[model samples]
Target chain A: MDMVRNFHMAQGLGETSYAQNSPLQKEVIESVMDITLRSAMEACAAETVSIADLGCSSGRNTLSVVENVIRAVCERRREATQQLPEFMVFLNDLPSNDFNTLFSLVPEFVQKLKAEHDDGGGILVSVAGAPGNFYGRLFPSSSLHFITSFTSLHWLSQVPAGLLNNEESVNKGNIYMSPASPPLVATLYFERFQKDFNMFLRSRSQELVVGGKMVFSFIGRRSHDSHEKINECLLLEALEKSLSILVSQKLVTEEKLDSFNLPFYAPSTQELEDQVYREGSFTIDSMKQAHDWTIHEYAPKMLSNFSRAIIESFICHHFGEEIIEPLFETYTQLLCEKLVAREDIGWSKIIVVLCKSAAS
Target chain B: MDMVRNFHMAQGLGETSYAQNSPLQKEVIESVMDITLRSAMEACAAETVSIADLGCSSGRNTLSVVENVIRAVCERRREATQQLPEFMVFLNDLPSNDFNTLFSLVPEFVQKLKAEHDDGGGILVSVAGAPGNFYGRLFPSSSLHFITSFTSLHWLSQVPAGLLNNEESVNKGNIYMSPASPPLVATLYFERFQKDFNMFLRSRSQELVVGGKMVFSFIGRRSHDSHEKINECLLLEALEKSLSILVSQKLVTEEKLDSFNLPFYAPSTQELEDQVYREGSFTIDSMKQAHDWTIHEYAPKMLSNFSRAIIESFICHHFGEEIIEPLFETYTQLLCEKLVAREDIGWSKIIVVLCKSAAS
Candidate 1:
C-alpha cells in the first residue's frame, strides 16, 4: 500500500518527469514493434481488436506502442480486406501512476486517431487505464487478443522472501543480486525469479485467448551467472561504489544497505526458454538479445534520471530525500568514468514474442 | 480532459468524503449480493474464477462486494463440489478515486481471506485495482466470469453535447436531465446515454466468456416521467431552489447554472431493457425495481451529504467551495419538509442480473 502511494514515475511534463525521461523504455518498445505488429495480424480475428499494454507507466511512450499497434493493424487490414475493426486499447500500471498526465494526453491521442480514421466511425477507438500488479491476474479469462510489456516484467511483485535476515542477509554489502554475492544468494534470486515468472505467465495465459500473442522486453543476463553476465553490471557496480562511499563516511547506515534488495532479476535466454517450456501455456516464436546500451546516446545524466525514476520511491522511503541529490551525483560520476573506460557496459536487453497455445 | 481531473468522488475517510457518505450505494449493493453469488456460481466454470466490481468508488464499500463474492463462492463450492477454485478479484473505478486509501485497507482484507480459508491451498485470493472508466474495455476478451457495477453507469463520458453552446446551455434552470427541460435537452441526454451504454455493453461482451454473468444496480426511475419516479427528485428540486436563491441574491451566475448539466441520468426500467435488447449481447435473467427510499430510514442530513460527495467536484469547480455548506443546508431543509409532507421522496432504484449468451 505504501509502495503504491510512494512509487510513481514523477508527475507533470517537467524535464525530470517520466514523460520526459522515457526514451530508453521507448527504445526497448520500438525494438519489438515489428514483431508486435506481425504477431497481432496473425492472431487477431475479432471485429473489435483488444490490446493491453501492461505496466504502462505514465509517459508519451505509453501511447507510442498503442499507436504503432493501431496504425499497423489498420493499414494492413485496409490493404488486404478493406475493413477495419474498432479498437479497444487498455493501458495498465500501478494505481499510483501519473494518470492525470496520461489522461491529459488522451485528447490529442484521440485526435490523431480521428485524423487517421474518419469522423463518421471509420474506426472507433476507446482507451482506458488498468491499475494493478501484473504478477497476478489483472484481466478476465480468455479476454485479450494481445498483451505487450516493455522493461517491466523484471519488476517482481515483492522483494524475494528469505533474502532478508539470512544470518546477516544473504545479499549483504549490496542491494541487488551481484557477482560478489555468494552461491546461496544467487540461488535464492533465481528461485524467486522462477516463482514470479511462472506466476506472470500463468495469469496472463488465462487472460489471453487461444493464439493471442505477448511481446515482452526486459534487462537480462547473457548467461546464468548472476554477477558475470548481467546487462546492467557496470551500472550496479557504480551504484554499489556510491553506497560504499556513503557508508564509509558513516553518512548512511550499512544496515540499511544490507536490508535493501532490489526486487529485480535479469533472466538468461536459457532460463527464459526453460520457464516458457515448463509453464506450458505459451510458445516462443522468436527471441532477440542485444547488448544495446550506448554511452553517447544515453549519457550519464539521462541514465541516472532513468534509474532514479524507477527506484526513487523505495530509495526515498529508506534513505530520505536528502540522500537523493548527492547519491545520484556520485552515481552519475562513477558511471561516467566507468562507461568511458569501457564501451561494453555489459547491459543486454532481451525481447521475445510468444503465442498462447491453442490447447493448454 | 478537465472532466477526468474535476470528476473525482470526494476523497479520504472524513465525514464529508465519499468513503463516509457511501452507505446509500452500499444499500443498493447489498440488495443484489445473493443474486451475484448464485448467478456467478451457475455461470462460472473455470478452475480459477474471475470477478470484477466496476465503478468501485473508494472506501469500505469497494471491498464489501469483493468480500461477499469471495465468501459466497467459497462456501458454495465447498458444499457442492468439495473443491474451491483459486479466486481473482478486480476492483475498478476511475483514476481519481482514493486508491491509496483502498490499498491501505487491502492488508486487512487479505487477512480476512486468510482466516476464512484453512486448507493451506483452499483458495488463493488475488485482488487488484483497475483504475479506468467501465464504459470502455478494462480487461481482455472473454476473460471475466462475473461483473458487478453499482450506481456508476449513469455518468455520461461527457455532458451530453448540445446541452451547452457558445451562447448558453439549453437546460438553463435545471442541473440535470429533468422533465421541465426543453425537448431538445432531453433528447440530447437520452442520445448520450444510448451511445455510452451501448459502448459499455459491447466492450464487456467481448471481455466476458460464454455464460458469464453481470449484475447491476443504479438509481433509476419507476416511470418514464423525468420529473417523477427518481429517488433524487426532491433533493434535485431542493438544489434547484437553492441555486435560484443564490442567483437572486447575486451570489451566483445564471450563466454558470445554464452551463451546468449533471453527467447523471436515471433511466426508466423501459429504457434499460431497451438498451439491453438493442445491444444484443445478453439476456436479462431478472430485474427488481422499487421506489424504496424511506425518509425515516435515511435522515435529510445523510442524504444531502451523499449528493455532495458525488457532485462536489463539479460544484467546487463551477460555484466554488464557498457555496457548499450553505447550499446543502438549503437543500437539507427543503428536502426534509417535502419528505415530511407525504413520506414519499420519489426515488426509485433498479437492480438487474443478466447472462452472456452461448454464442456472440
Candidate 2:
C-alpha cells in the first residue's frame, strides 16, 4: 500500500480541509459518542471506561471525540454519585503519523477539557498514544470499551489483488472504475471491497470485547451498481494520465509503470451492509449514508496534498524527479476535469456504528 | 454589436459576476467615488453637483456609489451652506435591459437614501433612470456634473471591423487575449482593441461635461505582450469547442457555427492608457489595476442564458429547444477544461478614472 502511504504523505503537506472542516462527522461522532458511552456506562455499572480511536491520524480529532464521550459518561455517572469516573483515551494511528504534532497540542487540549469540566467538578481525563495500523492489530484485546473511526475504514491496505488479475472478475483494459470506461472495472472494484470489508469485520471482532462498540465511517458510492460513481476511480484516472505522461516522457520504464495501480475503492452502502451481514460476528446497531457533502469545503486541500504527496512522490520514487512537475500538472488537470464534469457529486461517505453480537 | 448585446444580456446572466454580486463592485466604486467626487467637488468649486452612473445595469450598485458620493458631497457642503445639492441620478443600460427589475426597487432605494440623508439634517437627493447604452450617448451634453462607472467601460459595442475583415487574423482563432495561446492572438486582439477603443473614446468625448470624472473598472490582463496571456482567446477556444460539439450533433450547420466569434475583449492596463492618450479627448488622471478576477464567475450563468436571449433567438433559432441543454453542457465543459489547464494567472481587472480634457 505504497499508494496509500504516498496518498497520506502527499495529502499531509497541505491542509486536508475535508478532514478539518467536516462538521457533519464532528456532530455525528459527538452524538454517537454520547449514545454509545451512555450505554457503556449503564452496562458496565463500572466506575469508568477507556475509549480508543484506532488509526487516529494526528490524534487531535480523536481526543476531541473521546473527550465528548467521557463527558457524557461522567454526566450519567454523576447522576448517581458525587464522585465521577476517571476517563482515559488511547489515540492510535500509523507509526509514521505526526504523533509529535498530536502530542504537542495534547497539553492544550487537556487543559481546555479540564476547564470545561471544572464546573461539573469531578471527572478526570487522561490521554495516551498508540501509533500502529489497525489492520494488523494495535490495541490490546478487550482493552477498549468503546472505539470510533470517523471518515476512515473502507480503505484496504492496498487495491484488491483480484482487481489487477485478469482471471478474476472486474478488469477492463488494466483500467478500473473510470468514467467512459468499461463496466467490468467497477464490478471488480466492488468484489474486492467485499473481500477487504470481511477482513475488517474479522479483525475488529477479534479486538473487541463482547459488549464493545465500534463506529466506522468510510467513503462510498451512492448507488449499489458499483459500476458507476466510484470515488477512487477518478483518482486512478488522474494517476493513469499522469503515468502515461511519464511513460511518454520516458521518466519511468513502461514495465514499471504498467505493473502498478492504486489500492483504494469506495464501497456502496448496500454492498457494505451485505459484507457486514455475512461476517455474522458483529451486529450492526446503526448505518447511515452520508451521501452529500460540500467538496469545496474540503476537496481543494485534500486534492492538493493528494497530488503533491502521493503522485509526485510515487513518480519520483519509481523514476526520478524529472517527471514530477508534468505528472502533477497533468494529474491536477485531469482531476479538475473529472470534478467539474461530476459537478462535485463524486463520493458518498457511510457511517456505521455496530456492537459485537452476544453469541460471538 | 450584437455580440456586445449578447455580452450586456450575458453580463447579468453568465459573463459577469459583478452583475449578481453588486456589493463587490460597490466596495471598489464607492472608494472611486470618494476620490473622484472629492476631486470633482474641488475642481468645479461648487457646493452641490449632480452625479450619474453610466451603463449602470439595474441601478443597484450605481445607486450605492451615487448615494455615497451625494452623502460625501453633502457632508462637505454642510460645512458651508447647511444645504445639500438637489442630487439627481440616472441609471443607464440598454433598451433590452431589465428596466422593470430596476424600477421596482427604486422607490425603496430612494426612500432609504432620503432617510439616511435626513439624519444628516437636510441633504436632498432625487434619482431617475436613463435606459440607453453609454456607447451611443445616454446623457445630454454638459447637463451632468459628475459620473462614475465602476467596471463597465472596457467593453466595446462590437468587435472591430478591421480585425473581423482581416481573414488571416480572424482565422488564427481566438483573436483576443488568452493565456497559453499564440502571441499573434494577443497582437491581433490588441490591434483590434486600439481601433474599437479609439471609437470608444471618440464617442465618450462628446458625452462628458468639462471636469466630469468617469471611472471605468473592468477585466484586464497583466502583460503588454498579448502573446504571453490571452484570456479572451481561451474563452473563444471554449466557445469554438462548444460550437464543434453542436456541429457534430448536427444541431447547427458547420458554416454558421464557424463564422461566429465572441465580441468582447479584456484590455491590459497599458492598452487602456494608450487608448486614452491617443483619443486626444479625455485626460486620464489615474489608472490602477484592481485585483485579478475570474470571468468564470459570471460566464457560466451568462452562457446558460445566451441561448434564450440571443443565440437561440438568432444563430440556433431554427433548432429545437432540445439542443439547448447539450450545447450549454458542452460549452461549459470545454470552457472549464481550458480554464483549468492554464496557469491560474489570467483574467484580471483594472479601474481607470479619466476627466474629459478641458483643453479639448
Candidate 3:
C-alpha cells in the first residue's frame, strides 16, 4: 500500500470509471455542505485564497467540491460588501488517478463561472493538479488556506507491518478490521491509523497558515470496540467470502489471498478526537456522525461498483487481470444475496471541521 | 494529444505488461553504450550530478538506463581517483504510466548498488519520478545536468491541428504520414514537429546548466520525404488497414475511425540539426543513424504489443474495450501477411548528443 504507486481509480470515462460510479461520495459531499461553506467563509480575508481537496479522485465531484468552496467564499464577501478574491485551486490525488477526465470538464466549469459573475467583477480561477499522497507534504509552507477531503482518510499509508503470517493466525481469513477478527488484530489496525492520521495532520499543519481551516469526512463507527455491528466490515466480509470461494475452486491461490490485506481502518469519533488532541496542531470546531448507508435495494450494486473503482487496481495487481471479470461477477452476486438478510448492517461516517491554532 | 493525461505504458508484471514486452528497447539501450559513457565521464566534476530520462515508460529498461548512468559516473570517478558524488536520478514519463511496477523494483536496485560499491563510498543515490511531458517545463531553472530520451521525441505534443476532416479528402484512408498520404498532409505533420521540437529544445536549454549535455534518440527517416521506403510508417499503415477492415464489418464506426490520428512525426537528421541550430541553446556534439528493425519473425506481434502498450489507453478511450482483443488479432494477422513481400522496410534511429552553450 504505497498508496501513490499501488492505488488508482479505474481508468477513463466508461461504465466503470470512477466518475460514473461515485454517487455515494457525491452524496456524502452534499451531506457536509454546511461545514465546508462555513469554513471557507471564515478564511476569506486574503486577496488570493487557496483551496485544496485532498484525495480528490477523478469525477464531477472533484470540481463540485471546489465549486462549493468558491460559492461559500463569494457569498461571504457579498454579505460583507467586499469584492471576491481570485482563487487558486489544487486537486490532489494519487499518481494513478485518472486526471484526464478531471481536466476534460474544466472548460465548461470555467465558462459557467464566468457567466454567473458577469458584472465585470474580475474574479479569476486558476486550477492545477498536484499528484501525490496527502499523508505527506504536497504544498509549500503556509500556502493552503482551506482544505477538504471526503471518504479518503480510511486508507492508511501501508498495510500494518505485523499482520503478515503471524503464529496465532491473526486476520487469516479476514481481509480487513472486521467483527470476526480477534481483538489483537483490531489493535494493530488502530495503531497504524494513529501513525498515519498523525502524519497527515502534521503535514497539513505545516502547509496551512495559522488561521486556515480543514474539513474532512470518512468512514467510522459509532462504537469503539472491534466487534461492533457496523456494515463497513460486513461489506469487506462479503468480498472476502467471494475471494475465498475463488481460492477453493483453484482459480486463486489461498496463499495469495492470505497475503492480501486492505489498507483500511474505520475509526470511531472518539478515536479521531483523541488523535487530533495528541497531534497538537489543530482544534476541532465541530464533529458530526451520520449513519446513512445500509444494505438497501440499491446499496449492494452501488457499493460493488464503488469498491471496484477504488480497489480494482490493487486486486488486479495481486490476482491477474484475466480473473477480474469473473471475480467481480461472483463478488457482485454474493454481495446482492448477502444483503437480503442483513438489515442491521450499515456504516456510519464522521465529519469534522478544524482550525489551525496560532499558539500551537 | 495530452500525453501525460492520455498515454500510458501497460500496467502490472503480467503477460500484457510493458515489463514483459520491451526487449527491443532494452536492445536499443545497449546499442547506445559509448555515447552514454562519454557524457557521464565529462560531467564528473560536480558533487551532485542530476540526470533525467524522458519518456521513461515502465519496464526493466527504465531502471537499466538509470543503472547505466550511475555505473558510468561511478567508473569515471574510479578512473580519475576522485570520490563519488551523490547522484540524483529522475525518471520521467506520461502521468498514466505503470509507475507501480517501476517503483516496486526500487529496493532490489538499491541493494545491488550498495553491494557493488562496498566501501563506505558516500555515494548516495536518490531517485524521484517527475510525471509530465518533456515537450514542456518539468524541472526548475538550471537544475538538470545530463538528460537522455529514447524512442519518444517522435510524439508531438498534440496531433497537428490542420489535418482533421478537411474538404480535399486527402489522407482519407491513411492514418499517418505515409506514402499514401497527400503531400500537404505530410507538410502539416512536419510543421507540428518543428514547432514541438523547437519548444522542447527551448525548455531544456533553460533547465540545463551551461556545458551540460543531452542525448536523445528517436525514430527518423534517412530521406526528408514521407514516401521513402521506411518500415516505421508502413508498420502503422498495416494497422490502419486492419482497423479499416473492422470498420467495413461495422465492428468499429467509420466516424470513429476517421477521427483517429496518431500524434507522431519521424524527422530526418538534417531536420533535427536545423532545429537545434535555430533554438540556439545547444551545439550538436555527435549524431549517428542506425537502420535496425524490419518485419521478420517475432517483429509483428512484438510491434503490436509495443504499440498497444503505448496507445491502448488512447484507443480504449475512443473505441470500447470489447474491440481490443479482436482488433489486435486482426492487426497481427495483417502485419504478418504484409511483412512477407517487403524486405527493404526498416526504421532508422538518429541519436544526437548536444552540449549547452556557455553564452546565452
Candidate 4:
C-alpha cells in the first residue's frame, strides 16, 4: 500500500508520462470520467460544479482528466441555460506525497484555466490543496460536488501480516501464491481494505449530498482466482529472481530472502464490483475492464520507475537501502521481459463510476 | 545454445521419466523416429545390421526408441529367419555426458534388449565410448547401420562469432537477436548452426550404410519471421534481465553488459525443413515440434541451471563470476513477472528425425 502511494506520488509528479501515453489508460479514464461527470451534473442539476481529485497523483494527466470531466458536464448544462454554479477543485493525495512539487505547477494550471474562461467570457473556478490519506476521514460533509480517483484504491495500507512467515509447511521456498496459502492472507488484506474503503465511501457519501458521483481507476487482475498463475506466479517470480541475485551476491542471506512476499494485490473487476455492491452506499453507474495497452503505451518509463520507487522505499522497507540498485535492475529487467513476451499481457487499470443515492 | 545443451543433457540422464511424463515430447520424437526408422528398414532390406545412438545424452529411453526400431525390423527378419543376420547396437554421447552414470544402469537395459530378441537373442548390443562433438566429425564413413540423436544437432559447437561486436552500432547494449542487432548475429548464429548441422548430417550420411537413418530433436520456434516474440523477445529478455542485474550490482559494469549477447538461434520448423531439403543428402522423412514441459513448468530453474552450466561458464566468461547470483535473480524475476501475469504462454521445442538413403 505504501508502495502504491509512493508510486502514485511519483506519478502525480509527471512521472507517469509513460502511463498517460498508454492508449488503454487514456481511453478508459476518458470514458469513465466522462460518464461520471455527466452523472454528477445530472444528479446535482448544477450548471457548473466543484470536482475533487482524491488521491490525485502529481500528474498533469489527473488534472487533465478532471478538466475534461468539468468541460463535459458544463457543456451539457449550458444546453439547459441553467445558471452556472461556481467551479471549485481540490487535489488530494497523501500528506507525504510530493504536493510541494504539485503546488509549484498549479499557478500555470490556474492561469491556463483563467485564460480559457476569460476567453469564453464568464465562469468562476476555484482550486485548492487537500493532502491527506484517503483511508481516514478528510473532507467535510456535503462539501464535494464530484470526486475522481484514477488508478488508485486497490492498494491496502500495508502488506497483510503473517504473509511472510515462510514456514516449512507453508513451502515458503517458492510459494509465490499457492492455491493453498489459505485465503487468510488475502482475506485479511481484503478486510482491511474493506474497512478503509467503506470508511472512504461513508465519508464520501456524507460529503456528496444526495447524488454526487465518484469515479475511480485502478489496477486489477483478469480473474478473481488467487491460484491463477499470472496473478500469483509472475510478480513473485520476478521478486524471487531479484532475491536470487541478492543471495548470489551474498548481499542478503538466502534465509532472509526466502522469508518475504509482496504486500499488494490487484483484484479483478468482479471483485471490485462485489465490494462496491456490498457496501450498498453507492449505486453502480458504470464499470469496465480497461484496455491494458492504453496504460502501457503511456507509462512505459513511469511504469518501471514507479514500481521500483515503491518497492525500494515503501513496500519492503526492511530491504536494505544498499540493495535498491540491484533490486531495481532485477525488477526492470523482469518487467521488460514481460512486456516483450505477450501482447495481451499488459496491466489493467479499471474505471468505476458510481452515484451516491438512496434506494428508491 | 548452451542452455539447450544443458537441458538436453539433464533430461538425457532421465529421458525415460521425461518421455513418460511429457507426452508431447514423446509423441513428437516417436513419430519422427518411427518414420525415419521405417524408411531405413525398407531401404536396407538387409537381413542383419548394426544401429548406433550418436550424441544420445544418457538414457535408456534412447535404447527403448532404438529397440522398437530394431524389433520391428527383426520381426520382418524373423519372417525370413534363414536369411537373417544378427544385429549389433552401440549407444553414444559426449565425454562430458554422464556415460558412467548410464553405464552403471546399462546391464538392465542390455538384458531387456537381449530378452526381447527372438532368435536365441543374439542381438550384439555394444555401448561405445565415442566422446566428441558431432558438429565437426565423429564416426567413420560407411561403418554404421542406423544413427540417432534425440534433442541434439541444433546447438552450434560454440556461441557464434560476430554476435557481440560492440563496436558495431547494431551490436550495442545487450541486444540479443535484436531486429537491429548486427545482421551477422542472426546470420552468423544461423550459419554456424547450419554449418555444424550440415556437417553432422554429412558425417552421419557417410558413416551410415546406403540405407542408414538418423533421428534427432532440437529447439525450433513457431515462426520463421523475425517478428516472432518467442525466440527474439523472451530469450533476449532473459539475457537483458541478467545483464541489468549485473549492471545494477556494478558487477559486469554497464559497458561490458551492453556488449554481451547469447550465441543461439532456435529456428522454426519450416526453416529446419528448408535446411534439410537443401542438404538433399538426407531426406527429411519426418519432422515435428516436441513439447518441452521442463522448459515450460520449471523454466526459471531450468533456464538458470542451463545458464550456469553453459552460458555463464562458456560465453561471457569474461564477466565477473561474483555477480552470477544477482544476474540470475534479475533474469528469474523478469521471467516470473511474465509468467504470473498470464495463464499459459511458453515455447515449442522442435524435434526432427531424417534419413540418409544412398539413393537420395
RMSD of each: 4.9, 26.6, 7.9, 33.3
- The sequence of per-residue lDDT tens digits that candidate 1 reaches over residues A1-360 is 154445677766786787888877887777778888898787667877878898888888879888888888887887886578877677777767776567666656766876878835556666766666677766657768999998887777777788876547878887778777877777888898899899999989988999899988998888766657454667677787788888887878999888777777888899999999999999899988887755457788888888777777777887888888889898888878877887666568898899999879
Encode model 4's per-residue lDDT on B102-140: one tens digit a residue.
444444555576677745634544333344456644444
* A44-131 per-residue lDDT for model 4 (tens digits): 5653365778866554656677666656666666777655445656676654454434444544565576566553545544444454
Interface DockQ of each model: 0.15, 0.00, 0.06, 0.00
Q: Considering summed lDDT, which 10 consecutive residues are worst modelled in model 1 chain B?
A: B225-234
lDDT of each: 0.78, 0.58, 0.78, 0.58
Question: Interface RMSD in Å per candidate, to 1 decimal?
Answer: 5.1, 33.7, 7.7, 39.1
lDDT (Cα, tens digit) per residue for candidate 1, span B225-335: 655534456667678878887888777888877787778777888888999899998999988887665545788888889888998888888889898888888778876
Using TM-score, give the best candidate's number.
Answer: 1
Task: Locate the minimum summed-lDDT window of 10 residues in model 3 chain B.
Answer: B121-130
Q: Is candidate 2 or candidate 4 better by TM-score?
A: 4
Q: Each candidate's TM vs. the true structure?
A: 0.80, 0.43, 0.63, 0.44
DockQ of 1: 0.15
Which regions of candidate 3 fall more than 4 Å away from where they truly are?
A1-18, A29-149, A156-186, A198-216, A220-264, A268-360, B1-20, B33-53, B66-147, B157-166, B169-186, B202-214, B223-264, B281-346, B353-360
Where is the poorest 10-residue window by lDDT in model 1 chain A? A1-10
